[model samples]
Target: MNDDTVTATPAAPAAEPESMPAPEQPAATGPGTPDPADPATPGSRRLLRAGAATAAAALVGVAIGIGIIKTQYDDPAPATAAAPSTAPTPTASATPYGAKSNGSHFGSLRDLLLPVPAGYRPGPDDGVYGNDTELNGEQLSAELDAELQQIPKDKRDKLRSYWEGLHVKATGVRTYLSTGDDLVIGLKLRQFNQQEVQRINEYTAVFTGDTGLFRIGPSIPGHPEAHCYLMPAPPSAPIDYLECSAAEGDLLVIMNAEGVAPLPKDKIVALFTLQLDRLARPGASA
Candidate 1:
């Protein structure tokens, strides 16, 4: 599949008073003299009115700030027990979501037809596909060239190597709407026999080093003949991505799901299975 470096948090602000405390509760000097709370003195009344206005303004600012944060970071609601699903959860495991990936047999990776899930819709415009286009192509596309410039030159080679060795036979780029806009998924089918799959798995087993600006992640749950890795972006990059592949028959199917938000493990698996199911159905194009 197209290689994509995974994506990119901030510190919460301390809840201190946005405004200075009102004049440190002016000392009540001379009991008979004007007290700060005394309505009898116009200056005392003015201070009280000013304090009320400042407090009200601070409350308004806080409410607006919270509204912005929630809009930017809002996430899907947790799945509820009563909700029904054709997709069932599997026995718990050590994988990123404890998912038991589809172990069912399949004829070929080339036959699987990908489907856009419910919450996911197609991207607005045609988005160029690849892990990150610049890293995989002989010439970086205009957009990717810009994203790459964000990374330092010394780190470029390492990023290129992540997809440099992979042998891909075909690639399909599809845009989907999955709780967000322009979520791009790249599906790659590679030619790899049983022996080759074993060798590749062994190679990835000990392969640990700099991935340029990309962050390598742990293997996901179940698969037929390969492992899944959570590919994240360097702290500097703008988005996130995931890569999972396994040998199916004579072909290795690699999936690259990416967006500004990190996709859940189960959802990626769901998309994978959806493609496989499409391929399995009679007369359906993979």
Candidate 2:
């Protein structure tokens, strides 16, 4: 946003009044007596006419003086001295209206995805066929259609209608493996309408909150909205699994971890934190 400065202009000074000629005075006359030669005399009437002219001139002068005084009182105040010239300090531009922390985003959704970290190579692409890790709208729609195949037709139709209302826009995915223990980390980001993205957290809580099949996982510190769930493996099973999801802006961030019975809970939380941080702070390096 830019700052606006309002400046006031000084009013011009009122013009000075022009000088007026003084009227001639009438000659002195005795009470009840008139001089024939005097213009103000009753016979000639000149003295009376001269007296009237003098009085009119005086009245005009008085009126002119009053007008000048009123004009001075109504004039605007004088302008202040100009400010000193100096280099302007730069200011950061305001964030766009539709772009906010954990509410909305305006840039490429794929750009907001967390970058592949050190010691981990790019995981298998989740897009249709051998497509890139980033999925376009059409590809995502096809994937959804495939997933809906297992459900009954009526239920699938209703779910599809609900999904359509979400207006999913894009998706990004990355999978990587640790150098040791063969631990695999899969990350998926889905961008949709903000309202639908928010509902993901609520849905995850209801479905994964207290199911006997999965144990409560570690909470993402500093991110109360994020939730994690761990599937308890059978005694003879060789691997354990964990899933975490968070609603960040218009993106639903998901992480799936599979490894030996004892998954690195700390590392999982740390990675999830990094991904969430990336979404929250668009300027930060992925």
* Worst 10 contiguous positions by lDDT, candidate 2: 1-10
- Which runs in model 2 stand beyond 4 Å of their true positions? 1-102, 125-132, 143-151, 281-286
lDDT string for model 1 (87-126, tens) is 2222244332110233222323223324445876443221
Clashing pairs in 2: 39-46, 39-47, 40-46, 40-47, 40-48
In candidate 1, position 77 carries an lDDT of 31
lDDT of each: 0.34, 0.48
